[model samples]
Target: MAPPAGPGATAAPDAAMRALSSFRRRRLAMRGAAPPAWLISLATVTIALVAWIAATQAGLVKPLFLPRPGSVIGAFSNALDGRIDGAPLLDHVLASLMRVVAAFVLAALVGIPVGLATGLNPTLRAALDPFIEFYRPLPPLAYLPLVIIWFGIGETSKILLIFLACFAPVALAARAGVSAASVDQVNAARALGASRVQVVRHVVLPAALPDILVGLRIGMGVGWTTLVAAEMVAASTGIGQMVLNASNFLRTDIVVMGILLIGALAGAFEFGMRRLERRLTPWKGKV
Candidate 1:
């Protein structure tokens, strides 16, 4: 063939270079089109920190009441360095986490089965619905005195309080989930010679999983809240205890640290639950 009419005898090299350039341009455009979510989050945090620092520097707020971020960071570091009594920050965090997990597990263990039975069976629902309705509205802390009397002012009492807080929500959610199972699915399973147990396992349980997970999330949050209250009663070690101690000393830094720590921990747990829910319910549509 007579050489191409361009500078290069052939257009192949030019086409390849153009394709590569286009790809690079596209990638650059994509990168520049939107800021990463993490960057936005970091920017937000930076803005908050700057605002706080400015407020403190301007003396708009008292350091005693609202210490500078550096002070909080220093206190946190000091807590890690064994400046505080009792235990390190990690220990306190671990202790609180342990109690919350144990209580939540106990709540799930007791509540799920009760919910299934009550929800699936008319007679059981009739019998237990009244009690559930009665107690669900009542605050778990309100029964702390009775729980302590029954279980003593020890781990058992605290765990029981958390369990009570978590249990009602789980049961109610489970019951709602079970009841919400599709009638068509149940009938199809029945027609296929599946037993009631099979129907529940393959149809009801799978369908109800989303609701159950939602319940678990809500229940865990309640359990965390209850843990703090329970720990306040007679805890020797916990974030709750830390807050109580800080309050006694009027160490607002420590108080703020304790509150922040609880929020951070709760947020961590919530994140974990969300991941778990996503993993388990891959087939379910997003909420």
Candidate 2:
């Protein structure tokens, strides 16, 4: 067999080594080219700062109305230095975050079961559909007065407002997700002697997770929007309170800072939710 084909007869080792080297080089190149998210974020901030500076210098807007980027940064620094009342900016952020968490948890706890029941039972859905439709259309802020009256002008009222804001979206999304589940999958589970609970646990919940997460995301956004309105009622400390107070003083720098902080917080919260969704539902396609 020609001495069992000497090393010269086969270039597989050399080819394999070249292929491995090529893969490593490609990987290193990709790593070098991958843009950092922080860098993109910094670029966005720099662009906004440049725009603000240009506008201020060109006399396109009044300082009292727009303020310079430097002023906003100064306000942020002052806030950090304990120049403001009712705790620092970070405290306000944490307070708002805590309220959001409380409200979201409350909404999820109640909404999921109601949604499941409504989705599984046509009669129940028919009975509750009218009420849900009516409430879902009504803005949460519009009901703030009534909520305050019922729950008092305390944390309860604020939390309830957020809960109401979150609840509608979550319940609606859950119902939709459950209804959209594949009938074939359900039937197959049944054919395999799976009980109703088993089918729901093994098939329905998993399939509906993506939709449920979507609803959660929407609900959280709505809740954040409602936060300002809620704080406008009886809040002593929060970013919303900061914005409202700044408006009274005509401190445009603080107002702008508050607004930017709100947006940043909302974006951060949404990003976290997206990450959580990815982790929980790895089988789902990337957003």
How do all models score by TM-score?
A: 0.83, 0.82
lDDT of 2 by residue, 191-220 (tens): 999999999988888888888889999989
What are the clash counts of all predictions, listed in order? 0, 0
C-alpha RMSD (angstroms) for model 1: 9.1
lDDT of 1 by residue, 64-183 (tens): 888888888888998886687458888888888888999999988988888888889999999999988998888877888898888898888888888888999999888988976889
Q: What ranges in model 2 sit over 4 Å off?
A: 1-46
Candidate 1 ranges beyond 4 A from true positions: 1-41
